[model samples]
Target: MLRLSQFIFKETRERLGTLSFLINSIKFVTLAVFRILKGLFMNGTKVFNKEKIMQQNNTYVLIMAGGVGSRFWPKSRNHFPKQFIDILGTGQSLLQMTYARFLQICPKENIYILSNQDYKGLVMAQLDGIAASNILLEPSRNNTAPCIAYATYKILQQNPEANIVVAPSDHLILKETAFLDKITQALEYTSKNEALLTLGISPTRPDTGYGYIHFEQEAVAGVHEVNRFMEKPVLKKAKEYLASGDYLWNAGIFIWSAKSIQKAFQTHAPEIAKLFEQGNSVYNTSEELGFIQENYPNSPNISIDYAILEKATNVFTIPADIGWSDLGTWASLHEVLPKDASNNSKSTDHLHLEATSNCIIHLPSGKAAVIKGLDDFIIVDDEKVLLIYPKSSEQEIKSVAGAMVATYGKEYL
Candidate 1:
């Protein structure tokens, strides 16, 4: 009996020891996994959690569609801006494409378009199923500062902890996966810190048309501190900037918390901040239009860069190589559109050209045209109006459009 009891006791002890080892092994593996997950999320290497990272419930998007796109005229008119047209020939308007891109970042209800009150119908027609309230109409053309303030403050009222991505409606992004990743990175950083972050496109050329962002060696999780902002530079300065390697083209894509941006406005431009604050009570309500109509235009006319981004001390930028183009000019549009071996972009096959190189021809579908001996030109035919101008003189197109409006009538425009 004593031997049998010893045998049983030894067997029980060995089983307990094996069980202990298994538990310890499990605990070690779990700890390692937890740390790995924490590191991945902290470094922005991976997205976790449904609310913050996966579904992005707290993320909101603001699409700036108020611009008249005067540079793209005869094709882009005051009544019907370029944002509403299928400039890319992809059957999707720029506004529609922009809105669709944001949907992948946030909920459909969280998207907002800040456009002139005149374009509300166009906005609705393009973005079907979007809630009418989601369209934030600007009472007047007060530029970006006022509309941004209005939209940010209004979003704050709805979700005080909102993370907003402000983007132009007319830009084109070819590498969407890379672009979304950068936006997610910026959004993640803003969620944890009180930093105003913007994406800076790595410059591929010394182009003078884009604003440049100067960043310092200081960086946090891939975002660098912005040293200063430079407006469109001359060719010489642009080359210098490209050589320095510290400059990035300002993409105007910003990500920030509503609280953070609101604080910046309050700190830098108290008047603009106060102007929108008064309407907090009426925002998201039926009385909002009346309040905006009466008070929005009263706000100062200033760009967001001048109003807050330039003045804010906590500005940061993430250098990204995502294929981005503001599509600010016809020449810019030509660069991205599919081209032929001769370096010409034509929207329709009806256009037949001979000895033409470096030209862009846009015309209505099924409208046939034949041209010869033209190089580096823009030919656009939009019912009742035709524009054929040299690409080198495209910079003056804006003033030319205004002159046409004055000489002829707004009807032609």
Candidate 2:
């Protein structure tokens, strides 16, 4: 081992003699040896899978992945939504990434997925080791209120004192350590208090796509009371909210105790509460399917924000700078991805381009593409359908997808 280490240092120093180069070379060699040792001793287990804090078996995760992601059409289809796709070019899909992120907080068996019944096969194929029963299948896409109601009620049956974190399967969080730290903090707070907490991202821009959250100036235990929830506003209103310094981009990530949220539903969304309450005995049993199928659609179609958080006085916000993105549209994806000198982001290296700037291109592997004289545009070529549209008007892609479904067929979408 000493001989091998000396040989590496000698070769590195001979090739690059500068002081900085020698330091970097030593660091690289050290990292390589460390990785080898860790692989041998640890058997490739991840850093976050430690047993220290994950013993909080009362902590649970509910990943909401029911949306169609229509704005990212051609790539994100109805049958194959964004959550099941590796839109970031990462090996793991978004749903897999989300599940892995929560392994630091809770045990594998503690995690659950809230998704439409149609994506059952896709969800199972993407996420390994999750219980088939843990995948709470929604009979219909009744939005988030019904979705949360079912999961909250169901988890209550298994563990009446569970504290849960609800996150979207498709959102991207770049700063994992900080994000997890915030999650740990939120879980700590929720385990103790009756407050309903949402992780609010500090806005980097006046983004009009996301809903804005108005919060109080004071904080208790690093969380502030939410004054109100604002709808997606116009450009002028978004800019005003950004300038105010009292607003955050509502990230839709929520944290609460099972008992706290259950009570909120009973008080604010009584109908939804009563509807899901009937499944108390059947939540974790063989009768869950029959119970949900018959009763889920009867609940009102509403968002948790509108139904509970907006009305509940216990709503709180954790202002976090976690480098988050909803990845809602092609424009949003472009901003998060790496760009070239010309500011063009491409998923495939097979693209030949000239004078093309401020564009996002995604193509299947090994598919060569050549383009010229394009600016501020989205170019996505899924094997079946290709889309080329202006980045400024990317919001219209949802309507365009609906048009395609109307003209051609659902198969194309």
Candidate 3:
């Protein structure tokens, strides 16, 4: 009986030892995995914190929203331009979208809208979150140079070491992530260098509406030196540009340090620069408006492209593949929107009786529109004015809008 009992005790001790070994093995593996995952998580958090600091410290956006969008005729007007309206059926206006895109890369307080004084109310109403002071209003439409000068001087007064991105308020970027990434990279590049950088879109077709930028094929740290800037070219020149493999569509988006641009203006456009520099004392104060009104007209009515970019020797180009469109015309808007099986795009549902091939219509929802046997046409109904025009003759819209305004008064416009 004693021997049997001893044998049982020995077997039990052996089984307990095996269980202890199994538990220790599992505990060791789990601890190793947890440490590895914890290290990865901490590293990722460190990277994110660094990026956040980089954006907050050095980034500011200057959105130019002062244009009278005549090309968008019945939909866009002088009082309420395309930037304030939802040109896309996406429920957000172009200005709002542009604002939102920058929020991902910078603080909301850092974004400023440079718009006409007439549209101040519209800008305030659309972007309620922005400070009224941040909406830099122009007394009259002198052009981009004055607009940029005012914003730059004001921003410089606030933060001397600011890196600014000047972008049009009405452009559409289909790939928002890639757009922000490129802009982030640009801000980083401009922060450290005295170079002036502009985002250039790779040309997908021979588009005559856009200006062209010829760049050196060799790139320095992912940026190319600008060979030359060409105005909107004729069809033959545009086609040649497409074939050259060295040109990109100028996106009208620019990035530079506030100090760099201020210096450029001092060197190349000293007259305009001096006008704003004199207002340095009143820049971020209550006397700014009076100063701007007194001095804005003295500056030349020239675009920033002609004013500073063309003359600056340190200009560089970052060729970006982000899907972009200015959406200057109805035809361009149609290209971005989704079409039905019949290749007809519309903002509202409408009946199609044998209507086929590349037609766009904009009408209020529940409004009845019957389109038949039309191809490559544009139909817009804004309740007061209805425009049924051919897409091929879209360029005539500016003249047509002017004529209508002249004949029917500004109410129709």
Cα deviation of 300, candidate 2, in Å: 1.5
Whole-model alpha-carbon lDDT for candidate 2: 0.83
Candidate that beats the other on TM-score, 2 or 3, i.e. the better one: 2
Which lDDT value does model 3 have at 158? 91
Tens digit of per-residue lDDT, candidate 2, span 252-337: 99999999999999999999999999999888888999999999989899999889988999989899876688998898888756
Q: Which scores greater on lDDT, model 1 or model 2? A: 1
* Candidate 1, superposed: residue stretches over 4 Å from native: 1-56
Q: Model 2 clash pairs?
A: none
Model 2: what TM-score?
A: 0.87
lDDT of each: 0.84, 0.83, 0.82
Candidate 3 per-residue lDDT, tens place, 1-413, comes to 22332343344447657666334332233233333333433442212233653545778899999998889989897778899987776667899989987777778788899998899899988996789888898887889998898899999999999999999999987656567767877777898899899999999999999999999999977899998899999999999999998999999999999999999999999999889999999988889989988888788999998999999899999998777899988999887664555667677644554746688788876687667788998889888889989999999999998898899998767
**Per-residue lDDT of model 1, residues 155-274, tens digit only:** 898989899999999998765666788888889899999999999999999999999999986777999999999999999999999999999999999999999999999999999999
Candidate 3 structure, TM-score to reference? 0.86
Number of colliding residue pairs in model 2: 0
- In model 2, state the lDDT of residue 29: 46
Give the TM-score of each candidate: 0.87, 0.87, 0.86
